[model samples]
Target: MIKNEKIKATEVQLTGLNGEDLGIMSTRDALALAKQHKVDLICMSLMTSPPPCKLMGAGAAKQEKQQEKKKAAKTPDKRKVKEIRLNLQMEDHDRETKQSQAERILTKGDSVKLVIQVHGAKEGTAGKEWAEQLCKSLAEYGSKTTGIQVSGKQVVVQLDPIE
Candidate 1:
């Protein structure tokens, strides 16, 4: 926004500090009016034939911008991914513990990557069944985002939190 002496328009549509329209007048007159009110002559728009300007305290505008920045800084991104590893040989208690951890992360608005690693032969046929069962167990907290995929010795699937 052009302010005070920086404004080049010879005439402008002015508004007072109290928001009352002062109508169209010379830029010099508007500057003098702002000086009398101890405020800034800020050009609001340049689209009209004679640009529009308003009277406002510069310190107030600066404070508002600082407040907006602080408000933006307070919120953190929630799209982070948490990884949990499982295996076909996991015991009941171990599986339950991993499921609880995944549930905790999902409830906090983070996604989870489930990885079941198979060490021996028949990687595709052996690992997918266990992965499906695990996925069903976690259905209440999150939905599966990807189909069970088998690559070499690893079976991977992604789950996104329910919003």
Candidate 2:
């Protein structure tokens, strides 16, 4: 914000200390008025034809900026959830690769949802066991947030990164 002696515009749209419009006036007169009130003549915006300037205390402006910074710092960023699907009859090598992928995701502070699906008539009984074992193997990287859920031919569980 351009202030006082630095304001190049001969005339400015001035706003008073109490937010009242003082109309378009010479910058010298506005500076004098600001001096009279022991405040600052800060250019609020430079985009207009006759830039709008306000009379504000320098300390007040700094305090407002600090308050905004504090508000921003208080808000937390949201984490993303990654989904990985597994087959009930996955081979040992493939299972190990999937486990490593899940660990990588968890290390990055993201949640992982594991979905295990079984096909055919006789594979339903072992799906839950397979899912539970996979979850247990990944326990070091993340903790289970949801219990194993069995619905039809699928078993699902969610793991959240360890803080």
Best-performing candidate as measured by TM-score: 1
* Candidate 2: residue pairs that collide: none
Which residue pairs in candidate 1 have backbone atoms (N, alpha carbon, C) closer than 3 angstroms, thus clashing? none
Worst 10 residues of 1 by lDDT: 118-127
> How do the residues 53-85 of candidate 1 rate in per-residue lDDT, one tens digit apiece?
888999866775688889999988669988888
**RMSD to true structure for each model, in Å:** 4.8, 9.0
Identify the runs in model 2 with alpha carbons over 4 angstroms from their true place: 1-76, 120-122
lDDT of 2: 0.87
Tens-digit lDDT string for candidate 2 (99-138): 8999999999999998888774466668778778878888
- 10 residues in a row with least lDDT, candidate 2: 118-127
Compared with the true structure, all predictions reach lDDT values of 0.88, 0.87
- What TM-score would each prediction reach against the true structure? 0.64, 0.55
